[model samples]
Target chain A: EPEVTQTPSHQVTQMGQEVILRCVPISNHLYFYWYRQILGQKVEFLVSFYNNEISEKSEIFDDQFSVERPDGSNFTLKIRSTKLEDSAMYFCASSEAQLEAFFGQGTRLTVV
Target chain B: AQSVAQPEDQVNVAEGNPLTVKCTYSVSGNPYLFWYVQYPNRGLQFLLKYITGDNLVKGSYGFEAEFNKSQTSFHLKKPSALVSDSALYFCAVRDMQRGNKLVFGAGTILRVKS
Candidate 1:
């Protein structure tokens, strides 16, 4: 079955440095999303993208965070300046519609 | 706001026994509920979803859930458990009246012992 794919299974970055997480959603999917899970915490929604623009975002998705559909197949999340609290597992998901979404393996971001 | 609650933080069941993971939801308008399973070091895998129609929704891996409007609950059930079933399970809800973002519960860890 087709699945969303994320690159760099693990990443470690210095505090105040920038990091980019990449994802390639299923070819036919129309809606994309980003969610994060801190260790021993609930999965928190970050942002949702549709039509090449942000459709909605949560408080956790502040100015430091940005998402882009750089191409037809690539969706990327960029953190301008990483904070220690930014350390978590970031998941990429896509849905043909709003009903159900398929998720990628996730990128583990570690900021020291 | 829409939210989901997985009452039990963890549930333990023996192999070959039936298992149920409790999930209750709060939402305005109609509710779209879903269940996802996460194995160790893996992403959330879609198990099933309840949009409309039958209250009992069957999903992948011999799992099913019953949607109760009056109770406002959607509980995941499996007739017989297997050791492999041990994992973290999450219940989520989407508010149709609001937007497309999904609100997830804290998650329940299911431990099916052999």
Candidate 2:
């Protein structure tokens, strides 16, 4: 079965530095999303992308956060300047038609 | 706003015994309910969902959930628990009238012991 794939199982970045997380969604899916889970916290939605543009975003998704489908298969999330609170497990997901999604193993991002 | 609530932080069940994880949701319109499981160092795996059909929805790994519209609850159930079933479970909901973003509960840890 096809599943979303995220690069860099874990990442440690310095505070105030830029960080980029990459994901390869299922080949046939059209919609993609990025979510984060702080340690011992609930999974929180960051942003959703469809048709090469952001369809919707949560309040947590601010100016510092941006998502781009750089190519047909690769979706990327960039944080201009990382903060300590940004440390969390970032998950990438893809859906066929905005229905249930297939998730990646997740990239654990730790900002010091 | 749409939201999900999982009252229990943890549920312990013996192997071969039945288990149920409670979930309740609030949405303006009809809700699409889903149950997901997460193992250690893994992503959320789809278990089951309630779209628009029968109230009883069966999902992967011998898991099932009953959607109660009146009570605004969609609780996951398993006939016989297994040690492999020990994991963190999340309940999520999407408001049909709203957008597609799913609001998830805080999650409940299921511990099936021998």
Candidate 3:
């Protein structure tokens, strides 16, 4: 089965540095999303993208965070300045519509 | 605002026994509920979803959920559990009027012991 794929299974970045997480969603998917889960915490929604633009975002998705569909197949999330609290597992997901979404294995972001 | 509540933080069941993970939700409009499982060091895997039809929704891996509108609950159930079923389970909800973003519960750790 086709699945969302994320690169760099793990990443460690210095505080105040930038980091980019990449994801290739299923080819036919129309909606893409980014969510993060802090250790021992609930999965929190960050942002959703559709039609090459942000459809919606949560409070946690502040100015420091940005998402882009750099190409037809690549969706990337960039954090301009990483903070210690940014350490978490970042998941990329895509869906045909607003229905079931398939998730990627996740990129573990560690900011020291 | 939409929210999901997984009442139990953890549930323990023996292999071959039936298991149920409780989930209750609160939404403003018609709710779309989903159940996802996460194994250690893995992402959330879709298990089942309740959109419109039958209240009882069957999903992958022999898992099923019953959607109760009145009770505002969608509980995940599995008959004859296996050790492989042990993992972290999450219940999520999305209100049709609130857009497609899913609101997930804190998650429940299911331990199916052999």
Candidate 4:
């Protein structure tokens, strides 16, 4: 089966540095989403993108964060500046209209 | 708002015994419920979902869930358990009225021992 793919399975970055997490959603999917899970916490929604614009975002998705579908296939999440609390497992998901979303293995971001 | 509750933090069962992971949800409109399993160090795997269907929905790996509209529950079950089934299970719900984001439960750890 086709799967969502994320690059850099794990990342370690300095506290103030910028970080970009890359994901390639299933080729035919139209809706794309980003979610994060702090260790031992529930997964939290970050943002959803469709048609090259953000459809909706949670309060947790603040000014410092942005998402881009730079090309047809690659979706990227960029954090302007990282904070310690930003460390978590970030997941990328995609789906066709009104179906279950498939997830990627996730990018584990670690900030020090 | 839309929310999902997985009441148990963890459930332990012996091999060959039936296993259940309970899930209850609240949504203003009809719900789109889903169950996902996470093996250690891996991504969430789709288990099953309840859309507009019969109450009983069968999914991957010999697992099934019964959606109770009156009680607002969608619980995962397997007639018999296996050690390989041990993993973290999450219940999630999508309220189309609220946009397309999913709200996930805290997750329940299922441990099936030999």
Please compute DockQ, using alpha carbons, for every candidate against the native two-chain complex.
0.76, 0.65, 0.71, 0.73
Better of 1 and 3 by DockQ: 1
The predicted structure with the larger lDDT, 1 or 3, is 1
Candidate 2 or 4, higher TM-score? 4
What tens digits encode model 2's per-residue C-alpha lDDT throughout A74-105? 99999989999999999999887647988899
Candidate 3 C-alpha lDDT tens digits along B1-114: 889999999999999999999999998878889999999899999999998999999999999999999999999999989999999999998644534778899999999999
User: iRMS of candidate 4, one decimal?
Assistant: 1.2
Docking outcome class, model 4: medium
lDDT of 3 by residue, A33-97 (tens): 99999985699999988888888899999999999997699999999999999999999999877
B1-114: candidate 4 lDDT, tens digit per residue? 999999999999999999999999999887999999998878889999999879999999999999999999999999999999999999999857645877899999999999
The Cα local distance difference test for each model comes to 0.93, 0.91, 0.92, 0.92
Reference-based TM-score of each model: 0.97, 0.96, 0.97, 0.98
**Candidate 1 off by > 4 Å:** none
Worst 10 residues of 3 chain B by lDDT: B94-103
**Which candidate's DockQ is highest?**
1
lDDT of 1 at A5: 97
lDDT of 4 by residue, A1-112 (tens): 8999998899999999999999999999999999998884688999988888998899999999999999899999998789999999999999885678899999999999
lDDT, candidate 1, B62-105, per-residue tens: 99999999999999999999999999999999755444878899
